[model samples]
Target: MPGQETDRRPLSAAQLGVWYAQRLDPASPVFNQGGHVDLHGPIDVPLFAEALSRLVAEDGTTRLRFTEAGGVPAQFAAAVEPYVPEIADLRDTPDPEAAARELIDADMATVPDLEQGPLFRHLLLRLGEDRLRWYYRAHHLMQDGFSGHLLQRRLGEIYTALAGGTESGPALGPVSALLDQHDVYRDSAARKKDRAFWSRVMEGAECPPARAGRPALRIAREISFISSEQFAALREFGVRAGVSWQQVLIGAGVLHQHRRTGARDVLLSLPVTGRLTPAARRVPGMSANVLPLRVAVDPDATCEALMARVASAVLRVQWHQRYDASELIRDLGWPADGRRQFGPVVNVLAGDAPPRFGGVPGTAHLLSTGGTAEDLGITVTDGPDGGLRVDFTVDAAYADSVPLASHRRSFHRVLDTLTGDADVPVREVDVLDGVEWGLVVEEWNNTAVPIGQETLNTLFEHQARIHPDHTAVIFNDEHTTYRRLNENANRLAHHLTHCAGIRRGDLIGVLHDRSTTFATTLIALTKTGAAYTVLDPDFPDTRLNTTLTRNHITTVITDTNHTHRITAPHLIHTDHDTHHHNHPAT
Candidate 1:
């Protein structure tokens, strides 16, 4: 039998953030966090349902109903029916695993009701005679990554005790205990100190530009793994360097961002488990917060130096991890606009051992961590065979800009360098592997074609002969036909060769008032087989003289407006010349 609903209580800081985000997009499935575990050997269906129901009844966070009181959002613990696993016998399907996956994805896509009760769901699928999969999903307001693990571990304990006829451990602490922990810390002196510390640290920090357009609930993931041998070497190196393995990974991530954006100051949003006290850790609820971790990268320094800095920063942040980020935003008076305060997030999920159910071997697989507001999120977990598994989640809008596969490969290359040698300069670490280098340097740049040895004047003459009546140039709204322009150039060439005695290999200077005559003068100089240099009318007299003297230019052609600036020995004026014949000059 179920009891009456309890009185409404104020939401926690984390729950309040989730509440506003869901209200903004009520139909978004981004708030749903889901995963499944494959159990081998055997599973008792009825017994498993009883275990799950017991787990749900003991965890009050699972029965929370969200609603608005007056104008502020709040939550109340509602007495709801016991949660029984929905059984899907997929053994008759052609591909049981595939069918199960399709059904799970479709169910995850459906939005959960917030105002009513039951913010979580459970499903069980029979894949084979001896294999079964248990799926669980919950709204972010009720559970986080840590809470999800807690629930799974507790469920296994209950099932094992029922089968062995033994006593199980104590159930989870009441949700009110977690609430009391939050209330005690709200007005404590430690919080004021933390607020002051964060205020100083984020004094001049500006929000980074959004990696994708308007933040959507859609996400894209790419998963990769590192060899166990490499991971061992990395751990040994961490021991030698007096830093934890997580710090080394954080350093690698900071170096990666520095290489990509070339920013000396890199800020990453690190998701922290806000369960510092014993009471908070014992309860399964949303006690997670994301804080900014700022690292100043110096390319000239060694990799070990950066790791040392990261270790120190991590120590300081963990001490003050309970401070709510949203309150810090208010303290700093930042705008409510939806801009991210950091770049890519580097989430390191370590120390999660595999769970067993009643002497059956089981493996856990995460499907989604809810929709990420950050463009890039990297999650590093412990692999099954003692290696390292890295999962990259990206916003679909930013996929084209940052290719998931290439980014993963490049990050792996950086990790390899970090694990191999700490003496290497941060700038020397190559993001591209050998194959990517070959593609970029050799294949992509393989653009070459044979060149024809045709001079500019000869090419112009050929075009004029072919398209004689076509307009060749337009200057100041005046169009000149190719034939007419060629005739003008020929007359100027004849005047320059015979009248001024200009010859091949001579350097001629042209000072012009940007008109059609400038083009005619250039073509005429080329017709005489002499090189020409352009002298702008805007140049000073001294610069013009220096250019003419340096180039050994003796002859000068000018329009009337710029003649005053040319002091060369020989002078030819296009506007003053009277040669108008239409014959080519020899």
Candidate 2:
């Protein structure tokens, strides 16, 4: 592909918008695991420098040298010229490890000093002979673990290309157009279709799903495959088994964490890049959104079978991506209240490392960071150098990072065994590490609030003493008196219990409103020890009937106005029947 590589050019507005939004993600650097990288021996200076230059050029955002604009996005460059330390007489430092530690400290400090702009991108530091550290504090935005690793891969490719006597640079396209992409997103088929869907979804609804107002000081972690070779086999195996690489990973996570924690289900706020169009290069805000997948597993389900189920369910949701997620949540009657409504998120980033920049002979390590609510995340990267590195970020309180690190190694073993025995049941794959078991068990055995709490009730009532003799419901030129309404309620309650087979805990479908008949039905149901759930008269009858069936609503109590729409075995109406032996009007 590099043989067809194109030279660097400025990003079009659309590409710029996308990069701007991504790099400027205010909630990035989501992970906090950074350490020194010590080469086994002296580094190749010429090879490294050439690699850096080519990499900076390929990504566009990195090619920039700072100008004194004080901010990155406001202008396009840094506030000052970058300084690369001279490594000629660096003998005073103990060794590469000590030097790397110093480099990290300096990088951390400089990160905060980066004034939300260009200089924060990264500064390449040469420690001494055979040692190098790229130091610069990065907000979780400009790059993520997947992208970082990709960038490194690209860099190595470019470097190797240069080393192997090919310096013209990798092929390219116009700088990706991010802003145009955003504009296109605004007018895209999905956007237009979703707008209509959202309006209808939210029409006349007061209560909506709830969320915590503030972003918590968050920490996350992920355990992914540690062997590129095994991952490759897993890839082939996943295809043959009709599952995605991501589902395989998610299944692995569920198995690893559920078995240890005894959790039968888990909720994950999966993030989607929302890169659904060429215009995806436009609008740079949080194009990334979270989809809460409420996944549950039957205890008796084997890993292979469960994986098949998970894959299908996951694909179904993703395929229906045209719906407004917020609307879907409301329509599905999910909890809007911010009480960990579903569960913590688990993400699978197939990783976006550059696609083999020039095909290099080096390894790239990527550590993903930030997204305030990511409780746990897993990122997979395919380095050109034939290696796989797994990074972990965990809630400090839940488990030890060391254990996760240990499992990363053990997962490699599991991967190998699974791949070696493609037909082997997933559970039979040897799990050498106890920590992996613990995490899985904890995930499978959840402690979230039960179903009853999730779907709750809220009642509102008031007296008209505030407005004496006020008209409540005006129907067919007749006004219903609140006092009179209350009286009818008492009368109906007696009749419903004594004649209409009403009892405690029974759900009475109340198809009414502020209408006089509505008030009466609500009060009547309460007396029978029954709860009345309202169904808006204007809503489709099919929808209303579905609710009735789901809630086991036996009595459909309405006025004569609804006779044509609802005809159940037990339909009770007022005014239509007067003296017919008023034996409870059944």
Candidate 3:
């Protein structure tokens, strides 16, 4: 075993990618993968400990560590002693369950060092004489989602036999065999073909739009959404359409993204089980790869048609999913910039059989790592009674800023649309349900207000009369009271009415920067019963001249600096004597 520990090997493509990511962000726990399972009515501590130790000795990944040798990342089986599972006795605590939860939370908050040996750790919390909680933490470099379930099954099986006073079965094979097979697959022509297929799928593909105002990097927040009744209908529709539940769920996700982004061509990263051969399933290592699943949804296509497209896309990628995503990205020549390759990721995990440890019903809870590599990721797990549980892990930056409620509601709405009718066109389908529609119509769009034929100018005048000393206009450090604004506007109005022979309905061109002068001129124009058009300072001179001439505006009120540009026959520069006109005994 000591000699075997000296053997170093190159990591698989997927593992290499994760290693680079860890190197890039050393503090992130996004790649820390593990879970907690609670087993009630457990009494055989000795047997459980022995079974756990035996399982670890059998799985080489449990003692594996990753590091850089000669500037190249490599993994080796550490010459460490067999893992002795730690036991936390919380039975004497006031609230055993709460204490156990706190212990589990603390364990999940920490991450293991990859450069160090023993990438996995196990703990058994003694909640009470009959209650036990098992916490297993492993890095993604050595384990996948299915590996977690396998760990539970193997632990349960070993415990069952040992507790029953019988000898356990022979130890399972080490993860080295799986790595050997991966090496073989890496050199195979099939792998090359898969890479080609991926290149075609991702050619010229633009990165998905980032959520507005969301930070580029942050810890992940995991939340679970369960759909029992609605999933029943979704399952029924899948059966009727001759598609798998995975396809239906993926179609719904794609539809939700389409409605969320209004992008007909949507791209998502999908995690596919790379356990193509039976040998891959037995080995405990990361044999999964994330591939791009591109769905082209036609607005006129029916729900059935969209599902069919989803099914076809999924089927096409299934065989080629084992292709190394890192290599594929490199071959595609994606920029090395910080932008992500795709948008949200959708992972439909394999349905795990309910684990029972030593005749005690154990429920598995996948703990969050509190970090994510994508903007968002949705992991769909099978729930009880043929329902589906969706665990959404989103980047904290996005979770805090984006309104995912609308997306959640719209996801169910898409499911409803698909299950409610078989032949309904996707374009005609209402992605918003009744409540969401009400939110849009009743809550958001309630813009009705009584209008008693009062114009903005009349309202301003009334406010000026009532709040004469109130602050009316403020620009930078300059402020003007309502009385001052009204008085200045009245002076201008008098000049326009008497000196310029301004008549009602006359169009006046107002050209000024954002200041009190602009405000005063607008009010003055209204007071003189003449219409005013604000001229854009950025507009071309020819365009401004054409607009003034086309509108038949004879009078222009602007600053002295802009007076030279005005083509109107009558010009009243605010900085000139025109504004110094007496109030004329108002």
What is every candidate's alpha-carbon RMSD to the true fold? 14.7, 13.3, 11.7
In model 2, which range of ten residues has the least summed lDDT? 1-10
| lDDT (Cα, tens digit) per residue for candidate 2, span 1-586 | 0111222223322223323433444333332322222232445665665556545555534323212232433324332233332233234566755655565655543333223344234444455654455432344433333334434545555656765776644433222343245455556786676556545534433221233133333454554545566667777767766787778766666555454344655544555554555433322222344454545666565556767877865664564343435445556454433222233344665444333323322333443343333144444544334544455554443334224555466555655654675556544655655664566577556657545533211121234334335665565557765555545666777888887878998877776544555555676677677877887764556667777878777778776667677656688765432222233355
* Per-residue lDDT of model 3, residues 1-586, tens digit only: 1325468888887687677776766766666777788776845887788889988877777777888889998888777585789998998989988987787667666668886746777998888778778888888888877788778888877888877877666565668777887888878998878877887887656545444332434454445455677777877888876788778888888888887677888888887778787757777787777778898989898787888899999898887878876666556545333325466777776356777776786777776422365466777776645567676666666776545555666666777788786788777766777887898879899867675787877788789889998999877567788888888888888877988787888888887766777788888889889988998654445556888989888778778667777688878777422234443221
TM-score of each: 0.72, 0.51, 0.70
TM-score-better candidate, 1 vs 2? 1
On a 0 to 1 TM-score scale, where does candidate 1 land against the true structure? 0.72
Name the 10 consecutive residues with the lowest summed lDDT in model 1: 577-586
Deviation in angstroms for 558 in model 2?
Answer: 26
lDDT of 1 by residue, 1-586 (tens): 1245558888889888888878777888888888888898878877887888889888888888888899988888787665767889999999999999998999888888888857888898999988889999999988878887888888889989888888769988887787777888999998999988998887666556444245565777899997889888778767866899888887778888888778888888878888888767778888788788888888998888788888888877888888987787666555344435466888887656677779985688777776566557888876667788889887665777767888799898888888786588888988988888999899999866443877778888988999999998777567888887888988888888888888998888888767777788889889999888898665556667888999888878876666677688777766733234433222
Off by over 4 Å in 1: 1-6, 434-586
154, model 1: CA deviation in Å?
1.0
Between candidates 2 and 3, name the one with more favorable lDDT.
3
Quick one: best lDDT, which candidate?
1
lDDT of 1: 0.80
Model 1 C-alpha RMSD vs. true structure (Å) is 14.7
Candidate 2 residue runs with Cα over 4 Å from true position: 1-47, 50-92, 105-116, 123-137, 144-146, 161-176, 192-246, 254-267, 276-289, 292-302, 312-344, 348-360, 379-586
Quick one: ranking by lDDT, best first?
A: 1, 3, 2
